[model samples]
Target chain A: MSRLFRSVSLGLFLCLGLLLISWWNLFAWSVVPVSGADVLHAFTSFNDQTIAHRIVLDLRLPRLLTALLVGACLASAGAIMQGLTRNPLAAPSVLGVNAGAALGMALVSTLPFLYGALSTSIAAMLGGGVAWLLVMLLGSTWRVGANEHGRLVLAGVAISALCAALTKAVVIMEEDQAAGVMTWLAGSLADARWQTWQAFWPVALISLIGALLIAPSLNVLQLGEDNARNLGINLLRSKLLGSLLVLMLVGAAISAVGSIGFVGLIVPHIARLMFGQDFRLCLPVAMIIGALLVTLADTLSRAVTYPMETPAGAILALIGAPFFIYLVRKRTL
Target chain B: MSLSAHQLSVGYHGHTIVKKMDLTLPDGRFIALLGPNGCGKSTLLKCFARILPAMSGEAHWQGQNLHHYPSKQLAKELALLPQTQPIPEGIKVKDLVAYGRSPYTGFWGKLSTQDHQIVEQMMKQTGTYELRDQLVSELSGGQRQRVWLAMVLAQDTPYLLLDEPTTYMDINHQVELMHQLQALNKQGKTIITVLHDINQAARYCDHLVVMKAGELKYQGSPEDVLTSTMLKEVFSLNAQIHRDPVSGTPMCVVED
Candidate 1:
């Protein structure tokens, strides 16, 4: 009964929070006062008569939706990865997927030939795939026992560093393209159009669904590989499917918002602390918390400096880094 | 035809651990595998549980090869309790036991009424019902071991393989666990355990397989296998084997 109450209350809270962000982004426009008629017009039709309607519908709505989707994707991916690996610190940033995506973007920006033909979304997916492939390869090669959490972590660190170096090399060669590279790397939702939403929405939705579907298997996996196998879970299959889900979530998220860090790392931990570690509950709770955090962060980024916007990624780091340190010190991790 | 291994050779990587060992497990019997550390008892049990691929041999459950059956099907026939490690921080005892029902669950893995009933019955049988809602990490060593046992029982298998179930347990807990295993065997569940204590193994097991240096030193009833010479040969110790007062099973006392 308490579990039901808690879940319902969490659902209510998530709905309220999402509504609040949606209202702030829609009903309240900064450059111009958005009257009810303008808001109605924005929803009913798109036109040049009301510049406010154009900004709200064309500009802000997609950005807000992107934030919510990307945030949920990263957080859900992080939760699944942590559960599958039985490690608290598992996230896309720590696992080298973000760095790999950045590398892919950097390469695309530098090479005019590739940038002219290939889309950023495809390039980002390729980069994430390569990074995960390397991690898996290195993981298999270690003489240490399979499913050693520490080995995967170490391999992630090595791969991330290598990717970072390659990104730096690209940056050095193409100093003229610094502005475009810097904006993407720092991550901004400033230009999130309908096209961007269309590109990533299906990928993120499928991955989230996949993650939730495998939540039960992850519960079994947390008992450790031997015990999970004894319980008839094919450990290799579970691990592979779990990794694929992570790749889709992280890959699509990075492509949309350019490597938003710490949402995956911190939101899942917060959800675990609030709800117990059962993935059945944690996955959805993590998704809601993630969407709330990013939406709130984006709102704050817009509100704090009014005219000059702050990056949502930077705000999350500023807030999340200290909270993460507190969790480490408290040993609640 | 209950459970047996034929010419079973087990290994890790390229190195062989147990070589061409053949053994049969009697149904509804309490069996113990006794060996010094690194004698491959754990490895052999892993082979029996199908956690490790046999290097070159066959393990049969009933008359069928264990490898030929699906993992879920095998899980319904035999369950294993591995050496207990730290439980994840906030898993409730009931949930932990429910993991044992993984093989029987659907894709969504909701606990059916029958699964819940069996889980409750297993908890009650093992005296862990009181700790059902408590997090596993909060339990004492002995209590935790009982919870693990309950989990294995929840698998609803006829045969159970336990690897050093009492490794970190206190003496009282060890005795309690042994009694529980005895009770389980009495209820027609076959139990195979690797035990470090020769006297305890002798006291509880109906059959004993003594191992040394990746080879079986002896296999028979406790009375046939628990000689002072066998003890010195396999365990490298001085001991005297005597009959227990209560159970009349062989009891070993090391001579100082």
Candidate 2:
């Protein structure tokens, strides 16, 4: 119980820390100089004319908010995947959602008539959903008696490779049409605007709430299939809702911020290590950790190269890849 | 209002494991499902627990179709423990057992005071109270088995279906588990267990159900069910029946 209290406090502290980091990210290392007081003033006063106020409201705020949402969506989705599959290595990126979404974005943006944001986002969601469906089907994840964990992961790896290869082929064939997509494909936060955030949050927030509502069901799933069924949980409903949540969360985040790779893979493990395997608790903690990690990484993306913005996704990969290796060495799977 | 099966055929991947069969269980009895390795005892138990869908027929609970019954209500009526349990990482014994209160708990699965008491009582009954705070992945095999039993017991159901419940237990724990189950049986909890020990089954169980090659071979009291002819026909064992000195139940003495 004390440990639970401690972890709860830790999560609250992380939230506070995230608020601070987000505040710092709003003004620090921007090409257009802004201040903390300017940030508060932009919120408190009418600021249609001032350049600094426009920069604060227009450019930085949306970027910071998008980073936070992308992190929370990916991390919570990762937690759900791990709990449902009972595999610690399970994440959206590893399971082909990221690669599939990228392939969808590449295909849409490279074509002449289909070059629109809303259409590309839809394509990403559909591509991710279809890819995940194929993985689940080929892996035989829902089948009984046969060992499915290893097979499921293997299927995801194969699908990811396939999607990535297709995306590369498309990008190479339409280099002039895909010039703008090249930087976005690197997972940068430079292009977020008020219009995209308006479209992004409502869907992302609803899916995040849905993820929390199913937290208890994810806990029950840890008991394996037959045991969970005996506990009165409708297996088909829970699994389907879970997979849908993953696609929505991943699709939205990947569409908003090109494919932030490692937050989903790493944040859930940290949450479970600190809070244990109870999804109700670990899931929210994972969201906080993910938001903080991405926000902090986005802030650091400015400092890493200074004045020349490194892609925040590249920053996350730098931190995430070694951690991935560490996890594989520490755990058997 | 009894647990019954009607021409049930259950399988997976289009391969049938249990063929068409019809049977009904006697309520408030300690029942033992005695069968050889491939006799479909566990499969039948799973069908009753609603863990597996029957391909052709229906399993009935309280005169209602088992599959059609609401999942939460069926959970309150029946609890099942399979042969093997996955050891979830970083879960405490107390919290693990508290999961049994899921059907009775609210939407978020928060255990109330009464739920806590039942969880405690079950942990104590299973001799796992001292290990309440220990991680499940850290416990030994026998200890883990007891913790799982405590979890199933904490479900507080009237009907229980256990498959090979005593697999990793020692001799003392095996007998202790039998005694505890017998006590629960006396208190009107109908436990149907697939047990390998014929002598132990006869000693504690009020009814015996023998199966062979997916067929129901016999069902009767211990005294009538432990005949040498039935033994040779079902288990391919040549055995003589004798009364147990300690329990006065029919015991099987094998002839080499």
Candidate 3:
């Protein structure tokens, strides 16, 4: 098959698979009534006032959409981060961006002043920005020679741990707010209301678009720092711009549904395996696979308990950890 | 256009590696920079290519300080192929070569028809056209080196700088790459390369710059500089020099 045809077909397959999973979860949960012809009935019925429609549209649909959005955001952010750092393992969570957003949300939630919905997101954005700045600064100082890849990874790990400690301390101080913060920290999509979706979707869309626009330069960057510079790619400007896009995507996703893990870490590797290493091709494929993986996880979360839903974050961990181990054993990453 | 370094001092993090190095390459000359390991030949070449920051002196290209030109314009003038492996994993050979056009491209740099033609010609010239669809990681050391050279060739610059471009290859591929570079120089592209092989440097280069411990030991034609005295002083080796049977270039035989 031609490259374009193969890519388009793969994309359609992923979209169809997500749709099937969404439908299955809806029927299994009795969110749409479990009839003998549940698939057919669910497709045809559109009574907005019915309990089934209300549950499917108001509750399940928003959560699903949130999962898809956050997953794509995290995966794209991870891909961009990995490309920028030129480290295969670099991701938002590993590089401290997620921890920073969580810290920001935790702080804002405890504020005595009445913080409206927008305040939490703004705080999360600031936290993500600050964390990235800290990583860059520390990494720069620790860079021993021409190769800074190892130093940057170490700096990211150190900063992530520090941010996690601060976040934990804040949680301890405000024990009452701890319950809400805990669920967010666990990275649940259950609380994704329409308002939360409104807050995150635009940032994710804009940043993803921006990332695709710069995808070509990323190929130049993969050639290493000196060669990329020789190609007339302004290394500093490209790094800063790419990091900013990552910050926006990751910060918005984290603020919407706190610290969803594994999607960022695993989706890019999977995309690289499936689509080869071209960033132009890998970015979109990663986004689709990211959406599919999270949606599948969210569907399993809703059905695993039947009536009682598990947090999608827990399901991702349960699925992702073993898959990650398998990848390591296979030496694919 | 010509490239000249005026008392150039280059190094990393405050320690000068190449100091007070003044050199000039007239347009279209094949210049070889020869030195022992850690003798600062690579540092000097990097300074000329603007890969390393000039610590205290100037690199002038076409009568203007190279530092004054924007990086894009500078890249358009010169290309460097540092001795390094191609990025690991599935980077296609054609895509790797196309990176040479990056300096001339805009933000959404689509490969123009001319750019594609140049890349195709470079691949053909470097004998990498057959491997255009192949992954760089799968190529042998010699083939990978040629692909890298093709990438630099696709840049279509007037001057090309290569740092030990013959490091990992066998004698045959090494000679082939040097011959290709000589051909390029003959086509009016000024070529400056750091070479470890003394005989290769003597045979291929129009001019030779010999360095010892970060300072110039000699600079002139290979016939003038690759003498027994200078070779022993710079390389700490006794060598006998003879005219090559074919090219009439200096041929060296080390004394035991």
Q: Candidate 1 has which clashing residue pairs, if any?
A: none
Per-residue lDDT tens digits for candidate 2, residues A1-333, read 887689868878888899899889888887878888888888899489988889888899998999899899999999988877888878998888888888888888886666674476788888888888888788887677554566887898999999988988888888885667777777888788887788789889999999999999999889888888888899889998998899899889888888888788999999888888888988988998898898888999998898898999999999999997887788764
True contacts kept of each: 0.81, 0.86, 0.63
Cα deviation at B65, candidate 2, in Å, is 2.1
Highest lDDT: give the candidate number: 2
Q: Which of the predicted structures, 1 or 3, would earn the higher TM-score when compared with the native?
A: 1
Order of the predicted models by lDDT, top scorer first: 2, 1, 3
Off by over 4 Å in 2: A44-50, A112-118
List DockQ for all candidates. 0.75, 0.85, 0.60
In terms of TM-score, the best-performing candidate is 2
Worst 10-residue lDDT window, candidate 1 chain A: A141-150
Q: What is candidate 1's lDDT per residue for B81-143, written digit by digit as tens? A: 987555767899999998888899897889899999999999998999999999999998778
lDDT for model 1: 0.84
